[model samples]
Target: MTTLSIYQVSKPHRAILQTSDIASILKLLTDAGVPFEQWPIRPLPQNADAAAVLSAYQSEIDRLKAAHGYTTVDVARVTPEHPERVALRQKFIEEHTHPDDEVRFFVEGSGAFYIHLGDQVVRLLCQAGDLISVPAGTKHWFDMGPAPHFTAIRLFVSPEGWVGHFTGNLLPGLVPKLDSAHA
Candidate 1:
């Protein structure tokens, strides 16, 4: 199930609000100016390649492109067996901001996105079918867990792909990672 948890930046150890309800999730995120939605899950082969995954979600992808002026669309997959899973996970777990909005639609598996607002941090656990759009310059970070496993459709305004500007904030380290939060 998808979950949303909000905590004070000063009180990282305690969440002020936490719920798995979809309506509440949408309301909170929408109020925060974060676009959150769910797309219908499409069927795919046992081991679907990027091409297959893209094909399955082409319509939704097209809609997003037209609506957001995204110039590039691609699929990103990370499995536990990936050679650089550790490195890749570490890279994303650090707090960072992008020059362009970061949009992702999870096709399979799950990941956690920690969005840092004014004085609060929103921890969103996005699973399959969840689509999240993080506006440009937002302070945030993602955790794919120690054993990562997910397939996400990503959209970008810049064809240059993901370019993250690291925010040297130790707040991410102060909060629990995906693995620890779940365990």
Candidate 2:
């Protein structure tokens, strides 16, 4: 199940709101200018089950299909053992650009997503069943944790491939981390 708990950047104890309802979650997040959704999730996914996770997030898939005409869903899982985890984390922290909209469906585990849009900073705690859509050109960073792990489906619209537009900003390691209780 997808869970949402909003916190005031200043106040930590009193939650702005918390809920497991997808519609309401989307409404509040979207109203806050945060793009999120709930897609059908496949279980114990790996190997070929990756495709199942992509299909689970139909709305996002549809968006990609219509906007960029992306085909061939690739389901991927990352754990503490993934060799590229360190490099990928470093790459994501630099705040890069994507040729197509960045869409990810969290099939397992949780990760913190910080979107830097001008003066506003939106931090999202994305867990299982959570669907996140980051528009192309948005600057952002994702933290999977010290033991970094997750199962996600990726969508690409450009045949040229996903490219990173590094801002050269030291954004990753400097960002504050969220506690697991709230994450």
Candidate 3:
């Protein structure tokens, strides 16, 4: 199951909205101009099956088009034990935003993505079925939590890779991590 939770930003202990159902989640996010959606895919083969995956990615991108106003979709993949994982993971810790909303769909595996807005640290534990939408220019940082794993379908309005306009690096050292109990 997929979930969506909105923290008031001023409050972290409680959520203004939380839902497991995709429709309800999408409805809440879309209405708020925070785009959201899902993708269904068969497992990829050992050989070059990028086309199949890319096709599915495109379909999801199209869905986001009408839902989130993204003009394009860009896909990025990182394995569980990749060498660059640690550096890339930390590089995203500083809260920032794109020109348009930042939307990510986890195609395989799980990662904890954090969005910091005002006072709330929105920790999103995204599994394979999950899609996350961070409203354009929203101050946020993503921790692909501890280990660098997962394949994400990223939707962007531009051709560039993620570029952040940061809100400084005064990140609070203490925050809850992703766990089964919370998810």
What are the per-residue Cα lDDT tens digits for candidate 2 across 104-161?
7777877777676564445677887777877788877777666777887777676555
Question: For model 1, how does the per-residue alpha-carbon lDDT over 1-183 read when each residue is reduced to its tens digit?
Answer: 899999888888777888999999999999999999899999999779989999999999999999999999889999999999999999999999999999999999999999999999999999999999999999999999889999999999999989999989999887778877431
- As a TM-score, model 1 comes out at 0.97
Best by lDDT: 1
Tell me each candidate's TM-score.
0.97, 0.72, 0.74
Candidate 2 error regions (>4 Å): 1-25, 32-34, 45-64, 178-183
> Which candidate leads the pack in TM-score?
1
Which pairs of residues clash in candidate 2, taking residues 3 or more apart in a chain or in different chains?
A: 40-56, 97-165
| Steric clash pairs (candidate 1) | none
lDDT score of residue 113 within candidate 2: 76
CA-lDDT, candidates in order = 0.93, 0.66, 0.65
Task: Provide the lDDT at 153 for model 2.
Answer: 76
What is the model-wide C-alpha lDDT for candidate 3? 0.65
**How accurate locally is residue 68 in candidate 3, as Cα lDDT from 0 to 100?**
50
N/CA/C clash count, model 3: 1
